[model samples]
Target chain A: MNLIIGNDITIGYEGEPVVSHLTFSVESGDYICIVGENGSGKSTFVKSVLGLIPPLSGKIVFSGGLRQDSIGYLPQRSAIQQDFPSSVTEIVLSGCLNRHHRLFGYSREEKARCRTMLERLGIAGLSSLSFQELSGGQQQRVLLARAMMATERLLLLDEPATGLDPQATAELYSMIDSLNGSGITVMMVTHDIHPALNAAGKILHFSHDGYFFGPKDEYFKSEKGMTFMKEAGHDHH
Target chain B: MIITEILSYPFLSRALFVGFLISISSSLLGVSLVLRRYSMIGDGLSHVGFGALGIASLLSLSPLYVTLPVVVVSAFLLLRLSQRKGGGDSAIALLSSSALAIGVAAVSIGGVNTDLNAFLFGSILSVSRSDALISLAVSLVTLSAYLVFYHQIYATTFDPAFAKATGLRCERYNNLLALLTALVIVVGMRMLGSMLISSLLIFPSLSAMKVARTYFRVSVIAAAESVAAFLAGFIASYALSLPTGASIVIAHMLIFIILSASGLIIRRIHSVIS
Candidate 1:
């Protein structure tokens, strides 16, 4: 079943469209990798999908029992965000904000779930530690745990591995791949195409030149995809 | 004992009661304001209240009634303006300076016989019974609001964008925070004054952060520090005949210095042990 369907979506800032005519649909249990070059409206499009920004035009239908509030989101962290004064446990528990009907307190079950998620991320012992004092990789894992607390169905990520070493990036991708394997639909925006494309079942490549939405194998054979692969290969070289 | 003798006076009791209330309210909201980088809003809104007080005094109107609405409105305006295309500092500067200018102008033009210096610097000893009651009410309201929306405020303070994305009405929480700050700052102006009230919202949180790692711990420590500092400062002000506001600020500074040094020593010890 299709969980989300975006039809002719135009997203941007201040009524000026950055990415126009974006049409895509995500099925349940599908991993969709949203790939784009810098400044190609990927972040803006993701924000619009998350309802953080209003779409210029078109409809985003959350069908198949998916509500906007039920989608977990992990935003790309800025330097200031990383240094925010909070404990690892506090940061993780904040993700449960959406799960509560009341405005204030969390339940015992929520606390237990947060701890379980932290344990899943292998950071339960760091729960009492300061969030700002953690290593970059650990911080990302903690954020992923936070995102997990928000939704059990669909998880959206915006460049989760932007500032990490190769080893950390690999570890994060593996964790995400495992998450997708566990039947949660995943949509991620990434500049890093290799591991993302490898794990993703579908690709939504945004480019000024064109938009490509299809299976990963078909994307790899497409003209734009070949160009992207060649460019990535050259950069690595 | 000196403490028992001091507590026997109505004026001292009123001052202590009002001071303790202001300290808790100030430090409660202080963590969010400081973390969200809206710390200056306290200072800015206090200036607006000061200006309103000056006008009220000149017009023979009650300062509380006049300053309360004016400061609250100014806080809303500042919050809205902060969302627009400008640095928050500029908006704060524009409103605060203008309010200060209007206050000074009103006081000078009306030739009010009141001590403007006391209003600016505060006279904790001058707290009346009615003023203490108002402070208590505002402080209770502020603390209740903080407790009720504690988790929401935590999420918003740490990551407003993500909070918004998660379908949380972050703007509503932000406005609630602003309203609470306005109330606290206005009530606090009677004790800490316009110039020093923001220190009540800043120093406690900062000092607490040096030793406490979590937001909850930081808040707890900050409220404790603020009340402790206010108590010590109040007694010292009476003993030395110093300005109550300055004395309280000094007490907070001294505590902050001690905590900072202790944090450094603890870090060094941990390094050596490891």
Candidate 2:
């Protein structure tokens, strides 16, 4: 079943299209990797899907029990987060800020769920620690746990491995792969041509010249995908 | 000793009460403001307050009547500007410096020099009964507003983009925060005065952050620190015949130094033990 459909979308700011003539759909349990250079509108497309910015033209519909805000999103690391003083548990609990409950306090069940998410992410022991004190991989996992508290169906990650070491990057990708195996749809924007090009069942490649979106096998054969793979320093036959 | 000395003089009592309230409100708002790196907004808005008061005095109208709307609007404008990337600090500096210039012009033209010292540095004896009442009301409102919106404020400060993606009206909560900060600054101007008021917002939060690892604890400690500083400073002002705002700011500075020293000691001990 299709969870999201982008119908002939043209996205950018101030009515100037950055990457236009785009159309895509995300089906349930499918992993879609968005690959492109910087300024390729990949981030812009993520914002549009997250409803941070409206598309210049065309409709992107969220269906199949998905609201626009219900998707779990792990945003890129920000400078403000580097030294921010917050406990891990509170960060996870913020994921449920929009949940239907009392305005002031989280319900016991919600608290329990957050605890479980932390445990599942293997960071329950670190829940009491301040966020900025954690290592890069640990922080990313904590954020993933927070995003997990938000939704169980879809996850959107933007360059989740930007600043990680090789081992940590492998760990994060494997964690994401396991999540996809458990029936959650993932749409990740990444510069990781290898994992992104291999693990993702579909590819949505944005470019300054144009864009491409299709199944991975077809993308392996397409002209734009071939050029992208070549330019990204990887050749797949 | 402090309580006895303060209540002996009604004006001192009034100054302490109002100063205490302003301290609490400013510190409470200071947590999110500091976390978001919007601490300078308080400084900026207070400058706007001075400019607006200048206008009010120039036209011989009530200062509160003019300062409230003008500062609040300026608060919203700064919030809007800060949302955009690049030059946010420069923009704030530009606006605030311009407001200060206008304030100087207006004050000079209006010839309110007789009241200038009280307006700039704050005077315990100059706070009227009406000003005390306004401070009380604004303080209560600011306190309750922070309480009610605490969760939203937390999420927004931590990450507004993520908060927005989760269906929060980030702009609305941000506006609410800005409005409260503006209200606090305008009322705090009565006691801390515009020149010293932003210190109330900065010192307490930074000091609390030195010792606390969590947002809730940081804000709570900030409020306690602010009130304690104001209490001690107010009493000291009466005892030593010092400037109220200067004394209170000194108190904050001293506490911040003590906390920083303690925080450093605790960290060193923890590392040694580990």
Question: Could you list the CA RMSD of all candidates, in the order they appear?
Answer: 1.8, 1.9
* Candidate 1 lDDT tens digits, B1-274: 7678778998888788888888998998999988887887888898998899889878978888999999999999888766676646887889999999988888887786465886798877558888888888988999898998999999989987778878889999999999999998888897777889999999999999888878999999999999999988988888998889999999999999999999999989989998
TM-score of chain A of each: 0.94, 0.96
Off by over 4 Å in 1: A102-104, A234-237
Taking the tens digit of each residue's C-alpha lDDT, what string does model 2 give over A1-237?
Answer: 999999888999888898797999999999999988889899899999999989999989999999998879899986336877899998999898767468567889999999999888789899999998888999999888888888989999989998999998999999899989999899999988877666899999988989889899888898888887888888666
TM-score of 1: 0.97
Clashing pairs for predicted structure model 1, backbone only? none
| lDDT of each candidate versus the true structure | 0.87, 0.87
**Tens digit of per-residue lDDT, candidate 2, span B1-274:** 7678668878777877888788888998998998888888999998888888878889998888899999999999999888779839889999998998898788899886966776777667767788889889988999888888888899889988788888989888889889999999998886777899999999999999999998888889999999999887877877798888999999999999999999999999989998
On DockQ, the leading prediction is 1
Clashing pairs in 2: none
Worst 10 residues of 1 chain B by lDDT: B80-89
Residue A124 Cα positional deviation in candidate 1, in Å, after optimal superposition: 1.6
What is the Å distance of residue B110 in model 2 from its true position?
4.2
